[model samples]
Target: MIEWLLLLLPVAAASGWLAGKRSAETVNADSHSQLNSAYFAGLNHLLNEQPDKAIDTLLNALKVDSDTVEPYLALGNLFRRRGEVDRAIRVHQNLIERPYLSSSQRGQALLELGLDYMRAGMLDRAESSFLEVLKRRSHIGITLRQLLDLYQQEKNWHQAIAMAQKLHEESGEATESMIAHFYCELAEQHWAQKKAVETTRFIKQALASDWRCVRATLLQSSLAMEKGDYKRAIRCLRQVERQDPDYLPEILKPLSECYQYLEGQDKFFFWLTEASKRHPGCTSLVLARAAYLQQRGEQKEARYFLIEQLRVYPSVEALQQLLALGVPEDIEAASEPWSLIEEVASRLLKAKLNYVCGFCGFGGKYCYWQCPGCKRWGTVKPLAVGT
Candidate 1:
């Protein structure tokens, strides 16, 4: 109540000042008294904590003149901040309808109305209001940002990309990463439709926007594999290691498939060995190496490698590898330890989220290109399971 009274102070003072100036010119003492009485009655209602009644009294008492628009805007914003979207919309709509409003005032009212509509979940109305502001070329950056959010929510990637481009051009902020993701979304759509040519084109566009886009590279590899181009698929998958080693886990199975198709078991071993050396403590690479060693009937070698790696990494996945490499004799002797290890590993693996949003620290088992908490793109990263 006190806060509302304080907020109304400026309006009351402004009305008094305007009335006094007009009174000197026209001597309208009777109208001035009525206005002053109405102002106090509104203030009294606010002080008594009758907010709704106070708002009504103030709205009725306030004139939509040049001087009053600022207070009206502030009041509407206050209502919006209070989560009273209906009242905020009423105030802003009333302000916008007044013919005496300045251009900037009208633009501001439109922006507020759009925000109210957004809060009310009237997205179509919000979009229309924002579009009107966009057409006027006022508040272009903010309007474009809101429109981009709307498009993103609606999954209209083309419109999102267009708005992001406009924002990039106008603000000189690098939105290429976001644009690349948008293109990747379109690429996924094309891939789902089996439009190979268009999918390839969109993937290329994604790469053009962000040369290090791991998703694009992954899609390209998948496309190549679909076409029976094993060598090309391997090349595309290999690019992911350089682009973002965090996504190396995603490529392992696919890369193994390509190697199998090419009948390049030796080459696959060599590459896995090299990768393990470069990316030390990588659980996926270590597991792949262990599998290769076991396949080659080098059980002792695989056990030694798993033990050596586990001593340094101390990860649940590494422990699993160690257990898998155990000899039949050791299995009986180590049965209890192995069971406990398995239980602990299962719990740890379950507790660990695969992806975490860099923006808001929101961790999830599944990946989200845009964080649900912070709504940022490319912020969620694959959590390193054993490294």
Candidate 2:
């Protein structure tokens, strides 16, 4: 209420100033006196906590003229800031209706109205208003951004791509990663619909947009695996580790699976060794190496490796790897909460990690190309320490 009063008082002063200006010009002194009375009445209504009455009084008190546009704009924005979208819409809509408004002034009004619509979740209306502003070429950067955000929210990747391209050309900001993510979105949609050909095409487009896209490589690898092309899958997985070693943890399991399908644990071990050496003290790579040792009846080596790695970089996964070595093979897999300890431990590991947004530290079990918190593209990736 105090905030509104603060805003209302300035508008009251502006109304009086306009009245004084009119009186100075010797034009309709009687009307000027009347407007002054109405303006004071509006202020009184506002002070009495009748906001609707105050707004109505103010709107009626101010004659729509060249000098009144700024006050109306300010009031409209104040209403918007207060989350009164309907009132903001009305104020801006009223401003736009004034036939004497300058072209740029009308554009400003339209932009405010569009923002009100967006705040109200009237996306279609907001989009139309933004497009209209785009035609006027005023506020081009902000209008393009609004259009892009609208398209992204609607999942209209095609339109988003075009708008992003325009925005990049105009603003000189880096949007390649976002364009790649949009292509990836299209790829995933196609893949979900079982259109492998279209999926591959879109994945290629994603890589072309940004070749460092790990998601694209991961998707391409999955498609290759589906076709029994293990070698191609391995190649793609290797590219993922190279492109973003932060996601090596994600690729490791799939990479191991691809190697297993090819009946080449030897090759998988070699890749894991290379990755571990390249990314030293990486817990996932160390554990993968330990698992390989255990499978090959090198239990002593696996235990020693786990102990050394755990001593350096402790993780729930690494600890589980160590404890599993102590669990005898005869224990029933379906035992009590105590028997479920390993399962609990593993679940905790997966739970603590999933995907995290680089921009805002938002972690979740699922990947959102657009971070739910910061809404940045390609910022969400597999959660790792220091990432």
Candidate 3:
């Protein structure tokens, strides 16, 4: 309320100046007198701590015209910033209804009114206002951006893709990554519906939009795995390492599964060794290599591999796996202390976030193609080991 009062002081001053200007003119002396009286009545309401009445009185004193339109617009924006969306809507609506506003002024008023409606959670009304502004070819850039946001919020990926393409054409902004994510969204929807052809079509569109889209490649790999084409799945999974090595962690388990289906653990171990040497920061790749060594009856080699990697990448998961490797093969011979320590480490690993958003610092146990915090596509990646 105090902030509103402070903001209203300048507007009140402007209103008074207009009233005095009208008073200076010989005509409408009585009306000017009434305007000044209304202005003071608003100030009196402010003094009495009745801000709502004060706002009402002050707005009533100001008439919509070339001079007052800007002040009203500023007031509405201030209200919206203060979370007073209804008041902002009323003010902008009033300005929009006036007959004397220029095209630009009316467009500005509608844009602000659309923002007001969005803030108030009236999305349909906001969409209408934005579309009207776009239809008028006023504020085209901002209108397209707002429409994109609205369509995304509604999960209307097709409309979002169209709006994003138009925005890209108009501003030369790089929206390919966003467009790729939109296609991925559509693909996932079709995948859920068991529409393989539709899913494949959208996935192809995603990769065409952005060849480095790891999500699209992952979807393609999943589709291949579903069709029992392990070789094609392996090929798609390998593409991810080149496209984004940071996502190597995401493909390790799936790669192992594909190899298992092919009875090619030796091949998987070869790829793991190369990936671990090339990207040592990814703890999962290193751990997978160690696990493969252990599975091949090379316990000592696996232990050494884990110890070497743990020195460089201090991961809770790596530590837990190392501890498990130490336990004897027979349950009867298992050391009680080692088992307890391994259990504790396993708990700690589960508590850690495996993925984090590069844009917004949002951390979660699962990977997300679009960051839940920043809502940006392809910004969340596997968290690097050792913080």
Candidate 4:
């Protein structure tokens, strides 16, 4: 009832103003009296909590004209904003049906109706209305943007790509990154369906759309590794450092696996050293190098390396690794305190967020090519594990 009253107040004011202005402009005293009577009747219905009748009475009283059309459109938009999508749809639909409306006015009404449909989750109706508005060449940019968002929501990547390109052409906004992510999405879908050829093709298209697309490179690397093409996988994984060094941690395990398959641990060790130097304070890279040294029976060297890294960039992970490696030789007697500290360290590490969305500040334990919070592609990045 209160919601209806809030909606009716504006309509009542607009109707009263229209009645006064039209009465002063013309000597149509009888017409003014009828308008006032209908307005009062709608107000009475609203006060009596009969909102549906009030809406119908108010709408019927406002004859569609240049003066009344704007007020009607405003009322519909207000309904949508207030989450009264059904009412908004009725108002806009009524305006669209009026033959007295100009082309631009009809287009505006149709656009508002489409928004109402979208808000109500009637996506098909929304899409049809937006497309019709596009054909009418009315509100081109906004309609294109709406179409793009609609296709994305439907997971229609092909249509999304097309709409994104059109939006870029219309608005001069750079959409290469967004287009590349859409292509990557298609690649992932095809890969899931075992369509390897289509997957590769879409991945190539993703890279073509945005050469700096780290997700595409990672997908290409995964595909190559699946076929036992370790050298190609190695090349692709190594390319990530150049594309976006923040994702260096992502490539480490894969790159290490590829090198292990090829029996090229020496080459892997050399690259890891260079990468760690280039991207210092990277706990994963530092840890990877330390693990590699420990595997090579260079525990002393690994311990010394971690000590140096911790001196420059303090990290809880590095301290934990150092503790693990520095367990006393007299394990029987010194074990109790060491076990207690290890448990605490393990708990702290598990509680830490491994990845975070740079765009929305959403933290998580796993990596996401698309941020779950903002739904943006390639915004989630591994957190640097150093203070």
The most accurate candidate by lDDT is 4
Off by over 4 Å in 3: 1-4, 22-28, 44-56, 327-348, 385-387
lDDT of 4 by residue, 1-387 (tens): 887777778877786688668786998888788888888898899889888788888778767766778888998999899898898999899889888888888888889999999999999999999999988999999999889889988999999999999999988988899999999999999999999999999999999999999999999999999999999999999999899988888899999999999999999999988887787788988999899999999988998899899899888798799888977465654678878878888889889898999899999999887788997778898886442
lDDT preference between candidates 2 and 3, better one: 3
Residue-level lDDT for 354 in candidate 2: 69
How does candidate 2 score on lDDT?
0.85
CA lDDT, candidate 1, residue 25: 74
| Per-residue lDDT of model 1, residues 34-55, tens digit only | 7778778877887788866766
Instruction: Measure candidate 2: CA RMSD.
Output: 3.8
Per-candidate TM equals: 0.87, 0.89, 0.90, 0.93
lDDT sort, best first = 4, 3, 2, 1
Top-TM-score structure, candidate number: 4
lDDT of 1: 0.84
Ranking by TM-score: 4, 3, 2, 1
Residues 139-176 of candidate 2 have per-residue lDDT tens digits of: 88999999999999999999999999999999997888
Model 2 clashing residue pairs (backbone): none
On a 0 to 100 scale, what is the lDDT of residue 365 in model 2? 84
User: What TM-score, to 2 decimals, does candidate 1 have?
Assistant: 0.87
